[model samples]
Target: MSRKTDPLIVRRLRGEERVLEVGIGDRTGVAARLVDAGIDVRATDVRPVAAPEGVRFRVEDVTAVDEPDAFHRVDTVYALNCPAELHRPIRDLAAAVGATFRFTTLGYEAPSIPVERETLGGGDTPRLTLYTATTRDGTPRGSR
Candidate 1:
């Protein structure tokens, strides 16, 4: 059986925009697929990484990035397997990188992963929901 991907993740790409994948594993299958579809992709991790050709790779921490205008008008930001506490950081990264779309994946239950409801500073922390603007078929219900 073939595993299905979340359609909202890739149905509207113009095939030539810059995309950033944060917390990407050793090999970025999504990035590869997007590149095959003609998008310019970039992969970044907290530590070292060796990226494939045609995909620019960076070694930087998503939470503490300090580069000014470091990206080339990023269209999308993918953060798979990221902890809920990291959501704000991811949001900051996307904003810093100029990403218009942000995609993230999380588990359904608590304790399965470290999803802290209260941030370290204190306040009602928002859960890392996918922003659910699109359907399973990738038809967006509203604009971002």
Candidate 2:
């Protein structure tokens, strides 16, 4: 299935030079596309997986990130179709590193992180929801 939200995710990261994609799984197409567009991107998952050419891969778990400087290395953190249980940990990781958090959830589920939602794709394409993390002050954390 095609990911309709890819464009929107790339758009939201327009000026960001680098980003870390969490829970990359076995697919690296998105990461490859972003890299082709001149954005520096890296991917991480709980288990090691093969990645597209030029896309760096690492093993990481959002729920149990032990690397003290894990989040500090990137300007943004994102996960596509992540589970609800991981929402808060990703948000916390972003906050702790002062990076932006963005993610898409599985359809029929709600996000656990506070976010501003945007819809992408039309017609038969499954409606995709893109979420951007917000600060406690009710503002997009990455706006600055």
Candidate 3:
């Protein structure tokens, strides 16, 4: 079976070793695609839920990241349709674990942190904004 992917997510993360999907309530599309692409995908949620085969699922709350070890050395930490309220915690979590942080918003809210944005899709596909949580000691990595 072919796994459906968020083209943008898979595009950015496809070659990475491992990924942590934050707040994966019931949506499995992203995880499935990652797994299919041979990336080790682990997912977390506040509730006890299951992921598709090949994905490691755990109950985790990014807002209060307790088991930092569970995230150690992961390539990335991402969430779909994340809210502004969650931007800080997960960004902190990813930074603490030395992983790249990325997410998409629900369209009704703005990012609460400094981020590098990318526009996803073209032509017939619907456009969505993808944000990479970043630092600006200067500025985001991709920007001069």
Best by lDDT: 3
Clashes of 2: 0
For 17-95, candidate 2 gives per-residue lDDT tens digits of 8888898886666787888888888888998898778777778777887553843467888888888999888887777
Return the TM-score for each candidate structure: 0.63, 0.85, 0.87
Model 3, 102-126: lDDT tens digits are: 8888778888999988887667766
Check candidate 3 and list the clashing pairs. Answer: none
* Candidate with the greatest TM-score versus the true structure: 3
* Root-mean-square deviation of every model: 10.5, 2.3, 3.7
Q: Could you give me the TM-score of model 1 versus the true structure?
A: 0.63
Off by over 4 Å in 1: 1-3, 6-8, 12-16, 109-144
Q: Could you tell which candidate, 2 or 3, scores higher by lDDT?
A: 3
Ranking by lDDT: 3, 2, 1
- Model 2 alpha-carbon miss at residue 4, Å: 4.3
